[model samples]
Target: MSLLDADAHTAHIFTGAWTRSGGGDAPVVSPSTGTVLGRTGIADADDVREAAARADKARHAWAAASFEERAAVLRRAGDLLQAHEAEITDWLRRESGAAAGMAGFQVHVAAEECFEAAALASQPHGEVLRTAKPRLSFSRQVPVGVVGVIAPFNVPLILGIRSVAPALAVGNAVILKPDPRTAVCGGAVLAEVFHRAGVPEGVFQVLPGGVAAGEALVADPHVRVISFTGSTAAGRRVGEAAARHLKRAHLELGGNSPLVVLDDADVEAAASIGAWGSFLHQGQICMTTGRHLVHASLADAYVERLAAKAEALVVGSTEEDGAALGPVIDAGQRDKIHRLVTAGVDAGAELRAGGTFEGLYYRPTVLDRVTPTTPPFAEEVFGPVAPVVRFSTLDELVELAGSTEYGLSLGVITTNPMRGLEIADRIPSGIVHINDQTVDDEAVAPFGGVGHSGTGSRFGGTRANLEAFTETQWVTMRADPARYPF
Candidate 1:
């Protein structure tokens, strides 16, 4: 059956088999038209505990499965994702306000995530250690039992799948709690994929719920690890809760990332990169270019060009109008975006292009003459508002870019790539790009940030995934059993 079809066998809370949620139904409302697209079951705290118990019960057998078996399942899941790309993209566009291009990107990356995770299943899990005595000693990675993955509404599929695929491939069972707002695309689609890919019963579950469910997942004794992707405020709470439970929490949190256009860079090309960095997916990305630091010589031209690009972008409903940009996730986010823009303008930043909205369709806004003190300039606006400021020297540029609490992604446009690297060396970001935009991701690349942006451990790539999902155990063996003396 199609994954989107609402049925008892494809409900919101899936534990071994699909089942109705304990919490009441939650409506999936379309951002564009304010229409109720559908309704799915909502999971409460009790349901989260139940899911965790089931996942923990099934984890040992899953961990004992042959490496080939785990790899096969992940590989099949990647293939299935490509097969249902169209349907999944449609769901993302309708439910999460993802633009057509953004939705396709999510599907593509999510498939690659599965493929990369598949490769991880067969990689060497441990290293041999030298021992002075007549004994063999080695450390091997092992599953940490059940993992809880809490995902956000924006970029729902990729964020959730990145953690889910790796945890499952590394032999840990997963209980995914996608944001209730994006339950269908983030939760239901994944449940269908794993179920069809021959994952064992009780090994994976998708519980779509609100704060209570998320809190329960963290507190559940059976869930030993949590991979959470969301706002920094919420991530801190999750981290604190996970620490209280002694569970490992891998957090990919919020960012107010910067894109620096060096003095010698081509103004037109830099503007193009800046526009895409700040406006793609309506700038709802954690790695979106929230601050644009342009060298003083090129600042004026850069602002003009950026404003022009912002004006040209068609902001409307992706599903209905085939717009280049879509709405902010919902009304609350829309209000936040506008409020930040207004505050910036009032605080002395000049509105260069946008600053208006029609219904939920917010125009791509450019705020020039923006100071560090300007609203949204130093904050994670998480909207399509680009604030451009000038830097007179390399020291000023470095200081400006590194000022924010977030250290996620950094982009630099420069004539000399080495010069860009030198600047990046002084910054605290986890990911950096020369002559590229701030928002970029690869399934095989280590993806995460530093400081408030994320935990130090990354989510993607082989080494990172293995470390994130598995625990290392040191084993020592002698020719004969050694006796311990009191």
Candidate 2:
């Protein structure tokens, strides 16, 4: 059976029920083999409006549902996701070009997201407030009515589910807009999971389409909050649109994170950490180590070690020949990655290893002698390319790392843990890791970025989830009504 056909209904757009929407079917093409796997439904402006209206209508009853009922739904969804892990992982590997490990990670995180959201249902939802007036006063959390979630092609399931599960648990109906490139695993799979879990009709819908669908979702008055995860440019547009519509936008955007290797660090250990950060899942993650800053004393050795590590990685289609690194998402991304590598080499950076591709598979690349001004170093390449630069002093390293507009994740590697922590404190970013790689996420930890990276309220754990999906309303009760001065 086809992977998409195994567990998820990929034939139609999910608007509570499967419905043929505006743009019709779009072929799901595999990045690994360049073959059409299946077809998924697409939504357009009108379809988005229809889904939004339905979600708005469904919001009230869901909000009024008992916490136990909502938690039961979430728990069931989590259980279902785990029970069908093999099918989901296969779909992820085929559709998203994820290797076994990466695909497994997605399934794990996705299930954990649902489980965490289930726990949110029973958490405290209100706070009692002290008032000067003789009255019982408190603040309670309420759903934001309807949430519009826009997820990216890379890390599709995790990105979409992070928002979708939380919003639903908090009692808001959701309309998810998965990237057209990854609609099946990202959108349709979630639809199947929630549907089988007994989510109320109109409480959750998946609309897979391109720009028009996303724009329509943002403009729709019924969508009270927009949770967007993608490129910085696209996120800016979503944020602006949500602002114009006067709604909350939780944006988890792009990053050009730095991995700092101190002179005191072990060259081999540091290289291993950097390689994992830069090459994992083809380095398409938001927190991939885009820039590697090595102490001038260890720069040469570090570059050689990192290059060796990059060269050792086997790049191929996992289906044909099990490989460490699978193909990138598509040709466009492959070309973009090559272009950045070419630009870096053209600007005097030495290509230490891997500046080549076969089909959609781009090899793990390492560039040495890269300066702060190098093209790939300055931007988020979003590929398996590590650009290493030398920093003469700690201050120089801090300056080089902080020079970029993107501030998502930062990693400091050193033997002295306190020293690493001190260095990490010097850099301003949403997430900082001492003696660890930049690419990391936990459902229990609050995840987001700062500055251009995101609109940093945050997006995990109890408080952040509540803040992201719920609004606080103040209420008061009195034994007798009191009159104000007329």
Candidate 3:
């Protein structure tokens, strides 16, 4: 299908029903080629309220349904996802400018989350506690109410599905406000799967729109909990809105993650892993490592190796094979990255290699002599750029790594296991990886950050998301009121 043709179509699903949005449409473009893939609506505040109310109404029946019933629906959704994996991957590649392999990986991850939620739903929410007085107390996990999810453009499907599946499996209706840039690939496809899975109307709603829609969703009293994955600034806004309603808010914000290389480390392996981790999705991921803290002893050699690897990376369109990295989401993001890199150069940091920007394509960048004063080191550079900072001692390195406001994820590469463990303990990040980069995420492991990174965990095989979307109720009965009188 033609890119313009795709852009003109809208895939809207609400309450198990499908329709297109009635409003001015925003074009979704490929970051690699600047080609329009599809257009989604810039939904108004009223439309967002309607979507939230629909979910609020559907929550009653959905929450009251049996666990088995919910599990069946999620499992069927998983099946539909698998059957349409190729098409979904194509859409992601076109809309997000994601490499084919990366797009496929995201689809697989989302599908796996569906199955994980299904399996988890059958498990017990609590265990009965026996007491001497024969007073029965058992905690039962229940849905909190309508959940509001705001997903980012990068990794839209993976993150969205991760949050949505668990929320639905736990019996809460969901309202998803996808990144306007990738709604067609992320929210639209998800709506299709939910509809085919026979989900009840209003149980799952995908609102494709802009900031106004997001503000409306978060501010709505009907939305009991808000789960947002985006920039630190946006996350703060969402949290504040949730606070107004005294609602629970889950924020997965931006990261300036650090990769520490100890003196006794494998420089080559670290460089390769860092290259992939930093450049994947053009460095758009929240957990992507943005800083490289190398022991001063090995700083020179490490930069040389890292620079060579980064230069060797194939920067091209997602459709091309052997392309390690693609373009940024758009000209705006591209320009932002350029300004940050330029500022870093002006701040006296040496531009080691790969500082090329043509349209949306930004060549992977590696800078040296970056200190806390440099914008590239202090701010979250959400592009294919890496800043190398040299530290002399372990204490200095630890202090430097912990200086950032974000405590999302950290990576340490060293041959000494004891030293690696010691550094991991000192890092303030929520997740610490030894001998690898920060991009290595496991489906079964608890994944999230601390401080400004995020508020809650995403994975870990635990029902964390389910618990976040649920509340506890206490019930009591007294055989002898006089014995237990206050």
Query: Which regions of candidate 3 deviate over 4 angstroms?
Result: 1-15, 130-134, 458-460, 478-486
Clashing pairs in 1: none
lDDT of each: 0.91, 0.91, 0.83
lDDT of 3 by residue, 282-355 (tens): 99999898999999988899899989988888888886666778778888888889999999999999998888
**lDDT by residue (tens digit), candidate 1, 1-486:** 465567553335778777878897878888877889888789999998888888878989999999999999999999999999999999999999998889999999999999999999999999999999889999999999999999999999999999999999989999999888888899889998998999999998999989999999999999999999999999999999999988899999999999999889999999999999999999999999999999999999999999999999988888875599998888889899999999999999999999999888899999999988998878898999999999898888888988889999999999999999999999999999999999989988998999999897569889899999999999998999777895
TM-score of candidate 1 to 2 decimals: 0.98
- Considering only N, C-alpha and C atoms within 3 Å, which residue pairs clash in candidate 2? none
Error of 3 at 10 (Å): 1.6
The superposed Cα distance between candidate 1 and the true structure at residue 292, in angstroms, equals 0.5
Candidate 2 global CA lDDT score: 0.91
Q: Which residue window of length 10 is worst by lDDT in model 2?
A: 1-10
Q: How many Å off is the CA of 232 in candidate 3?
A: 0.5
Relative to the unseen true structure, what is the C-alpha lDDT of residue 106 in candidate 1, on a scale of 0 to 100?
Answer: 96
TM-score of 2: 0.98
* Shift of residue 401 alpha carbon in model 3, Å: 0.6
